[model samples]
Target: MAHLQPKTIVIVGGSLGGLFLGVALKQLRKNLNIRVLERNPTCLLHDQGAGIVAGQDVQEFFQRHDRTHTPLAVTSHQRLYLDRKGNVIDSEDKQQHMTSWDLLYHVLRANFDGVDSEYAKAPEPQDNEGTAVYGYGHQVGDVEIDGAKPLVIHTTTADGNTATFEADLLVGADGPSSTIRKLIDPSVQRTYAGYVAWRGTVPETAVSPAARDVFVEKFPFFHSNGVQILAYTIPGPHGAVAPGTRLLNWVWYVNYAEDSREHVDLMTDKEGTRHHVTLPPGGIQDAVWTHQKEAAQASLPPQFAELVAMTTVPFVQAVTDVISPAAVLGRDARVLLLGDALAGFRPHTAASTNQAALDAMALAEAVGRIVEGEDAAEVLGEWEARVLEYAREGQRRGVEMGQRSQFGVHPLRG
Candidate 1:
């Protein structure tokens, strides 16, 4: 039996996957009414701090779908490994590229707006001629899709405003702790991975001139062991900044025993405090920067030590275990899950954003098929299959990494 095509989709999360899906769906189905629900109140300030490298396929997808006329600034295109002595051990100069997260978000946002512009400029004049627009600060409290059109939804927003926007489909692109998933499948939840991640970006000036030379000489940092950190500079707000003065980003992983009581307490800076950071929402207390820095200095080799020492400011992050067992969509298949909401890859693969972009493209194609009289369920099923396959591969690798860390085996070392 042929399935009903989804005419409306509600994307819950205005981050990478949600934004890209909005633009892609609008491009594919001009009449598709799309709304993005962002938990964040404002879009003025983007918190995406660092950059990542997208492979050829991802880059090509951007070129095909994104018509924002903005060119990506490639910071570097290689991953280099160095030993504790600050000497080069191995390098994969072939597969390297640098992309700031904020830059990608800006480009995608512009492209989404371009989609609206194209709709406005459409030669045809009708309500369904172009994608209708809406962005909500929704704290999705529930998702009940058992109705005639499968009214997958949220209860209300953070400010006590009730908004029940019904769509043919509901997309769960809301990251690891997806409320949509909880509403649909409450049994599955994210568990702790028994490890924590420490991350921060420092200005190039924070490091000595010699460190600057080393960084500019290479792009992404990695190691054969499981432990690896990538660092590169991207364009900052001001253009006149020195070449290395841009943000230098890195993440370090440390394993913690189950039920380990030792942990860093979250601290608040004083009124006049110069450096301050509120840990990301939902983040658990992590190892203190001082303790983490000392651990890195002691355990890591000299080359990594140099990078850690140079990072004047650092934030601790905890790793969690989360994965959706099955991918389910509405009867009409109007909405779907993408990126971390559906599947989260460990940072080791460095494929999180790339996977999100891929999800955008794949979901667009699937929705396009449904619009052309194909079975919406089948199309979505195929999309989910491909995405889940990639996700499973990533999880397999991540699990291996977690096991190695637990057993005192260093990650990245072959």
Candidate 2:
């Protein structure tokens, strides 16, 4: 009997979601060829300096996949709510783990492509694992899928050179603006949540002793009409988690009416580019930042206000929600969407990264079953049902949380 050919799996978008799925699948099967295409030309992605709440799934992902013993997060020992007057109004002992986006990305990249960085050093590849490739500067332009046939992908390089490749399975882990998602189902669209998060980070060393005393070791929050702010410590530059080395990350969600002048002006960068989703650090215009700082000072607790004032470069991300009609696509179910490509939850629930981790692990298990002589279509169908439910529930909860926090509207009583 002749041995079957190894399957080719292609993943678009090399961010957390794609890397998570790529690493998980690579670890499980040796008779596979995996390629992760990243649009960014540089090997290293810019540090967003944003904090991620390390939910249970995120921790479990690291526990199972991370080979590096390096520390990854800072611990918040309690939930602290501050009144507008800067006095503690409510406090509860609740521990939560926080990590930086840079830290997580570097760690996952190292594990997936055996790349060494300041945050994580890659280990030797296991002999049982398949070939894994990370291609940067490859922008996917088009895709073609046919019934029970290998999928075709066309990509264009930075220099405009085009290339085509074939894959037995295509995974769309690309984020909210995923080209794959558009190709799969254009009807589904992301709906803006009528607000934006003003985000910034201050190094622990830069924060005043008084502010540190109030925020350190605590997950702090402040809520008022039409706005909500939260802060926590996360690993600093290059994954530093030591007491004095970590960074204080804060996010203030403020309402902005769609197409309003304030919204339009805030989303416009210094370079005159209009950003739909995010205005990156240093890209925010001076006037916008100044006005936002004024708003922060007037509305926020003193400590929170001080943190915003101390920030050198602030960023903004428009909150949005999206849930795809289906997770598994294509006539053969060989095409799939994962992570933000499948569902983008509002940030209020802090479930975005957790959802990605969960999706990756669940798909890995399903793939494992398929590798063990199980039917691929049947296994993937079951996986799709499970993940869709998870994503929908997360999306619903995030929207509810956003509603309650931003508008003070509780869920309707039956």
Using lDDT as the measure, which candidate wins?
2
Q: Where in model 2 is the C-alpha error above 4 Å?
A: 1-6, 409-414
lDDT of 1 by residue, 104-187 (tens): 676666556432221122222334435645465677887666646557575567677877778777788888788877776778
Per-model CA lDDT versus the true structure: 0.63, 0.86
Candidate 1 Cα deviation (angstroms), residue 267: 9.3
Q: What tens-digit string does per-residue lDDT give for candidate 2 at 65-158?
A: 8877668889899988787877887788988999989999999988888889889999887877878899888899888877556789999986
Candidate No. with top TM-score: 2
Model 1 residue 110 CA deviation (Å) reads: 1.4
